[model samples]
Target: MEKIATIGLDIAKSVFQVHGVDAAGEVVVRKRLSRARVIPFFAKLPRCLVGIEACSNSHHWARELIALGHDVRLMPAQYAKPYVKRGKNDAADAEAICEAVSALWLKKTRKVPLQPRKFLDFCWYQVNFLENNISISGG
Candidate 1:
């Protein structure tokens, strides 16, 4: 089997947990990073495959990571769920993501295409505007 380095990221609104494995499938690093620091932290890492769950804001981070010269793969959260052990937490989720990506069956996992930032941002702004308008009318 070909060896490859991979980093699994469990992203959230503010904090993100990362699990990194080397070519030998040995864990090289595991840490929690804040949203503000995610890009900068990965930017310093050696080029490797970065796995993330396909959820809100995932494509944004994936694009940023790819722009920094790292390969990024987006896996569905359901596909990654089976890898989780008894304990469920951010660190566990990150480790599960890494394990899932390394599995031979990972080829079957669905890959989420990256979303355009401009389009996503525009949608968010529209939603916020609608919410604000509703609040004003209700008040």
Candidate 2:
């Protein structure tokens, strides 16, 4: 089988875990990064396949990474769950992402449409603001 470089990103609010494998299926890079540094990190990597779990903020990251010239694939978390071996941790999750991508079982995985980050951010901010106002009024 032809080998292809792949990266799996386990994203969160502030930190993210990344797992990478080369064409030969050899682990290339595995590390954790903060949200602030994730883009810059990928920006420095050579273009390759990137896999991320389809979740709350995934579309935003997917769009950003795709724009960086990498082939990005978003796999629903359910599809990735089985790949988890023993423990449930960032490293393990990252590895699962890598395995799921390289194995190509992801073709059937559902893909979520990308949403505008700014719009989501605005919605979240508005909710928070309303909550604060309600609290101030003892409601």
The whole-model lDDT of each prediction reads 0.83, 0.83
Query: How far in Å is the alpha carbon of 76 misplaced in model 1?
Result: 1.0
Model 1, residue 133: distance off in Å is 33
**Each candidate structure's count of clashing pairs:** 0, 0
lDDT score of residue 89 within candidate 2: 91
Model 1 spans with C-alpha error above 4 angstroms? 1-4, 108-139
lDDT of 2 at 79: 73
The runs of at least 3 residues in candidate 2 whose Cα sits more than 4 Å from the true structure, single-residue gaps closed, are: 1-4, 110-139
lDDT of 1 by residue, 1-139 (tens): 1233998999988999999988888888888999998988887887888888888888788888878888788888887899998598999999999888778878765444446667989889889989888443555
At residue 107, what lDDT does model 2 achieve? Answer: 78
